[model samples]
Target: MNKFIKLAAAAAVAMSTGTAAWAADYNLTISSWTGPNHGINALMWPGLIEMIEEATDGKVTAEVKLGLAPPPAQMDLVMDGAADMTIIFHGYQPGRFVGTKLIELPGYEGNAEAASVAYWRVYEEHLAALDEHRGVKVMGLSTHGPGQIHSNKEVTSIADLDGLKTRLPGGVASDIGRELGMIGIQVPAPKVYETLASDAADAVAMPYEGRVGFKLTEVAENVYEMPGGFYRGSFAFLMSQETFDSLPEDLQKALDEKVFGEPASRMLGQAWDEIDRIGREATVEAESNTITIASEQDQMLYGQYADLITKQVLAELNAAGIDAEAAYEMVKAEMAAQ
Candidate 1:
């Protein structure tokens, strides 16, 4: 009788295991500031979610809420239960991401997509385990492919940049802009057109190509390709700790497998390429958009800018108890590896 009862229990356990192998419920929410239908997130990230949904055979799904709210409030919104996940600027919380080696460390003049892939791969191996991201769960972090200045007037030399009230995407970019003698204006992206029309801004900094709705072609005539970029601004997708903890284990695994892994190459790389392509079209069509490739002298001068700014940034990071130099080296190492 005892043996029969034990056999019955073992059979039940086997049946449960087999059932588990079939399918299971897995669902999560992803809240984003950019419309899922367009922009950087759309350009690169959708395929990841779609792949996950299909791979799970509809047992798992990702619900994306794109452009649900303004970005400044996004971090708090996720923390407050208004959103389960969203992307926010690391620079927005100044000093928090310092020493992580990413935000605005110059000498990134070559390739954005290459740098982005390399950045994430290194961060996953080193930084994530280092408490660099303490309170938040980082889904992914990457930058706009690269930035260039599109302006009404040609910025041929240092003298050409003086007194131009340009639209600056605040933080390091604005700081650099002011340092370069432009009166920096901070207008939200949506207000750019009106600001340009009203003469509140003389120019805007945007990618070299492939911005959909921002309409750089309509307002700016000359594009000044800053050698080191005004700032290599980066964006991060994050989820509330509470929200992530509430998910079942299978769902978490699903999200990681379907979305975060090698998909970055597909999502981020492709989008930036598209944007870069589109930029070429806009520049040509505008007919007025002039590309001023930095001369040897200009390039030589930018090296001085890189030295000063990189030192200050590293000094500031070191003061806060991080190996800023190490982080900087990691970025360069990754770039060189490629």
Candidate 2:
């Protein structure tokens, strides 16, 4: 009788442990529109996933699903619970995102890491009022490296861009294209290679990483770089509010404290900086592509036009009651400190 009782007790304990284990495990699905080999998918997502698993003590984890939706549809996918999380390019939605364009404006002098950290801080302190991400939990914010002109032909001066059909991502990039008198072709990053290959665009305004990430080195063999670049692009990592709310309180706290916000943003930005370095090195090693440093006079002219766009954006934001100037100053200061 005593042996039988002990056996029964052991069985009950094992069943309870199994039940607890099952309850603790949560799986999150991340939707990515970029190619799997892209830095975000290859480095950033894996790093973030590891952080999540570590922070949650193995109770929660994530997996990335490619082409779950197109880039512009990401935010809506997460909001609608079609995907648990996604990264959004602020410029992709145009008028739907105004304050985010502040980070996209030119003249910020910093690598992706510093800019990304500052972006998160600025959003928390100032841009949160815009509530542009109302339906989702903002996991983090980041900026890619500086945007430079990449083309198949040598571009020595601003005049070279005039009347050239260039691929512009959107938002301030489009605005800058207009200012420079370039005929703009709008396309997502993934399509850039084919667009250039098919002669749809003569040039593209993108970061150094594009040379390799989008296989631009094979098509666009010349890069025109300005001191601080013509502009930067803003990106956000977001989570579904409903999915987050479904997590256990402890898991939620763990994600908030360790895996989300500034930490994740910094990780992603650092990855971009590293990948950009690799891309630059690859382009140089190829010896097929040419790097053109914009002349001092050309840089000055680009800077002046960039300033006009900045002022126009700030004025619009201020008109919308966002204290745009103060926010812009804060971004500068935060980035400098970083």
Candidate 3:
């Protein structure tokens, strides 16, 4: 069977075995934006639900519901108690996330797993003071695998990006887009395939997983790969504060101690790594698709661009009162230790 079929089968098994024989005492709802076939829905959510159920010893369970709101609206949806839990992309809502941008910066040297575990650590140590995610309880934090250029147009050198219209998730990715002289097109992840299909944009900056998750192989037929990627996208898995407060103290303690932070983040990050690998394999299998690794000269030149973007972002975060330099170094150190 194909990987999609395998994902379906694994999800079926997880959902079947995750819950209690008796009904759960607290059954939560998960609002997801990715399509059912996407790894976030097919693997990550189910894995998380299983963790929740196990951590609470079957007292807590969650089910995912798609289209509860758009990607940018998830935090508000949970805060409003419309949904008990959801994942929000930090970049989707610009100025609101400054400290969160620490993980999204380019040149982090690790898979999503290390970055995610480090993300939770850095948030607790440095970023939580910002209260950027003030109203909701942050259950976990994660970053996707390295972001790359996906396009119908071939991009062999950094200069080739000039004047190209690319859908860039706003954050450091947009900073890079500006430096590279590409026209920035902003859109939610769900809209990428149609946007490219309609020829509204010629390229998108996303992790390898987009190859399968967004069906990029069919729309964006070429992948321009850079070492360690252009950037990593940050994500927060959130739960309603009201929902957490409503749970009994023991259940709350169980969730927090066993399931909520690093554990959950690691699980999601590992899932990202897996799906990213699958996406790469899918790209290799697609007869029409091609991946162009950046030449050494281009890599050296891109490093200069990355350095400029990094300094500018760090300065912005420091101005906002975050110890961003410390946080940035910590992210690298933590990833290295991992």
Residue pairs clashing, model 1: 44-267, 209-275, 209-279, 210-275, 210-279
lDDT for model 1: 0.62
Each model's RMSD to truth, in Å? 12.4, 10.4, 1.6
Instruction: State the displacement of the C-alpha of residue 109, model 1, in Å, after optimal TM-score superposition.
Output: 4.6
Worst lDDT window (10 residues) for model 3? 13-22
Better of 1 and 3 by lDDT: 3
**Residue-by-residue lDDT tens digits, candidate 3, 195-311:** 999999999999999999899999999999999999999999999999999999999999899999999999999999999999999999999999999999999999999999999
Q: For residue 8, give model 1's deviation from the true position in Å.
A: 59
- What RMSD value applies to candidate 2? 10.4
Better of 2 and 3 by lDDT: 3
**Cα TM-score per model:** 0.80, 0.92, 0.97
Between candidates 1 and 3, name the one with more favorable TM-score: 3
Candidate 1 lDDT trough over 10 residues, lowest sum = 11-20
Of the candidates numbered 1 and 2, which has the greater lDDT value? 2
- In the range 105-148, model 2's lDDT, one tens digit per residue, is 89987899999999999899889999989999999999999899
